[model samples]
Target: MESKELINKSAKKIWQKWSIAIRITPLIILLALLKILTHYLGWEVLELNALFTSLVAGTIFLIGFLISGVLSDYKESEKLPSEISASMKSLVDDTYTIYKTKNTLTALEFIEFQKMFCNSLINWFYKKEKTKVILKKISEMNHFFIELDKEGVQAGYIIKMKNEQNNLRKMILRIDTIRDTNFVDSAYTILEAMGFLIGCCLLIIKIEPFYASLFFTLVVTFLIAYMFLLIKDLDNPFDYSSNGESGTEVSLKPIHDLRKLLIDFI
Candidate 1:
């Protein structure tokens, strides 16, 4: 059951229905047209079937290695939203704890701060703004703790909440590192060239029954192109979708759960 759920999530993230097909369609069409031309013109120039097999095996091995590395990062990313959410919830809970005992922390202010920070962070995902803005908002939370300290709230409580805030900052920076950098960028270029060369090899190689060549050409071209695109998207696990959109982004359910806790607390 757990495996099935991960499969479902991964499938959605990798393909997202029409988007995958649309991106690969051009590559497919080019390969298909080349396949047909070779057939009609009877232009089987030095069959590459034996060499093609070796090339494919090598390409697959390389792609698998790169994908495993990317997948490790992605699997780690799947846990981050929950981590951030839990950390954020602790802050809210701390505020609640302080408010209940000392009656000094402002509930309204914390609620507003949570809402603003969440919205801003999502906007950053959407490429609408810079992360510095979000970082600044996080720093602003220190003011609340400062006020708490002044109110004679226990120093331990204030320090703990401050620590939680720092953890949140660390997680966000970790996210920034993943989201901003591509893994094995040089390898991507090599694989892209390899995929193209493999497609060319498929186009030229003649097999028993011209239809067999055509079938393999289309299928192989599509698979290679699709996997390349999927891996590219997988690199950006936090590629969150907006307003009922489906995408390859890792699930943000924990973040939403934290939001619910805040709303209910309010």
Candidate 2:
């Protein structure tokens, strides 16, 4: 799988839908309670207060979800543009390859063959765009095996291929940096804002005094910041972390599997 798809698939497997539902359910309940109170509360002496509570509470919940949805859409869109670029390049390559390989045939037969080949190329490009991009990219890598005999003074030859270790390392580092510098997946930030808004709403209803709400709000804010920091530390899965390194093992495992196949073929 391509790196983006692989990470997405892994995320799907790791993060179940039920878990997400559970996390959001509490927030939904809290918002619902605020809505009910604002609509039904006795307003003989506090008509303005009831109006203010409904307006502010509804605004906060709406803003939070809207922000979350926008961020999610942006993240998904960013990935597709890159994939489309890679696939377009591969389609051009395939078409050119077919056109260059001329063979003798009848005039009608040759025309039919040309159409068939072009159609096949188009289908191949469309159906396997992600795999084609990965394959095409790796195929162009300048790989070489430098064998070292007794003395390591360039004793043996360098068997060069398109795929090179340097290229793979560079690609891995780019992905590593993306994961490291991710300010997008700020789940804790969302949670913190939600907590503070909830606290403020409670203070409005006299459930807690404004001073107590302020203190609790600060505590929730700090906790959210700390949790995000923890997630950021883990986001760079390629880097060594408290749990261990992420991509290192998977990267080498593929090389070993390829070596095994080559040995069997030989």
Candidate 3:
């Protein structure tokens, strides 16, 4: 009973880890069952042969396309967070320079903006509810900048500050959009269904040896499951926690370092 409990616990952990791809499991099971049925029945027909062959080819192509799409999305997810952190650092540095060189009072006002911006980013890392609040504060920061302009801040410096603010806003919006976007599209799901159906058809019509068909079916099913899990893991690079030895999980070190920089500068 203890062993069974342990197994169940382990399985639950795995299920939670791969839950993003849970929708595909039923289709995979259906395909496996169909493959097994085809072997058991030993159906041989010319029309079925042509249909199965075509389907097998299409399934392979679809899988390839889906893999490429998933990989591209994974790379983008991994890249965007670092890009945001870098942009934030640049904005902070620019604010510090303005504080030191031009106007101490304006710089002091900008410190409030800096704190709000950093708080927004930290909130984004922890709680999504703070996003709206942070965005509102960012709008208020813009008005503060307008006030600085009215106070006869140099035109060139104001332009630079405005450009930095705009860049930060764009980067934050991109991060928000990417976080909310689904990595796996509807077309990928549809293609996966078609692939499974086709795999079953191919197993039934083409493979003559029952043992060979069974072996291939098991291999194919395992490969398909592994592929789905791989895609799921890569889909959200920020959330992936399964790196084995090399510790390849996406790092928030940039944010931490920036926090330190802010403390020192402020």
Candidate 1 on 54-143: residue-level lDDT in tens?
888888888788889899998988888888888888887877777777766464477578777876766776768787887888999988
What lDDT score goes with residue 196 in model 1?
84
Model 2: ten consecutive residues of lowest lDDT: 142-151
lDDT (Cα atoms) of all candidates against the true structure: 0.79, 0.38, 0.63
Find the 10 residues in a row with the least total lDDT in model 1.
Answer: 239-248
Residue 149's lDDT within candidate 3 is 74
Best by TM-score: 1
lDDT of 3 by residue, 1-266 (tens): 99999998788667656664565568567766776666567563323456665765676676677778767766665666577667766666666776777666766777766765775676565544455775666566677567767776677766776676676677666656655565658856876687567455545554546566656666666566556556655554554224321122345667667677777566
Q: State how far residue 201 of model 2 sits from its true place (Å).
A: 0.7
What residue pairs are clashing in model 3? none
Candidate 2 regions exceeding 4 Å error are: 1-15, 26-144, 148-163, 184-191, 202-266
TM-score of each: 0.87, 0.31, 0.64
Evaluation by TM-score, superior candidate among 1 and 2: 1
How many residue-pair clashes does candidate 3 contain?
0
Residue ranges of candidate 1 with Cα displaced over 4 Å: 1-22, 105-108, 241-245
Candidate 2 lDDT (Cα, whole model)?
0.38
lDDT of 2 by residue, 100-127 (tens): 4422122223233333433332233233
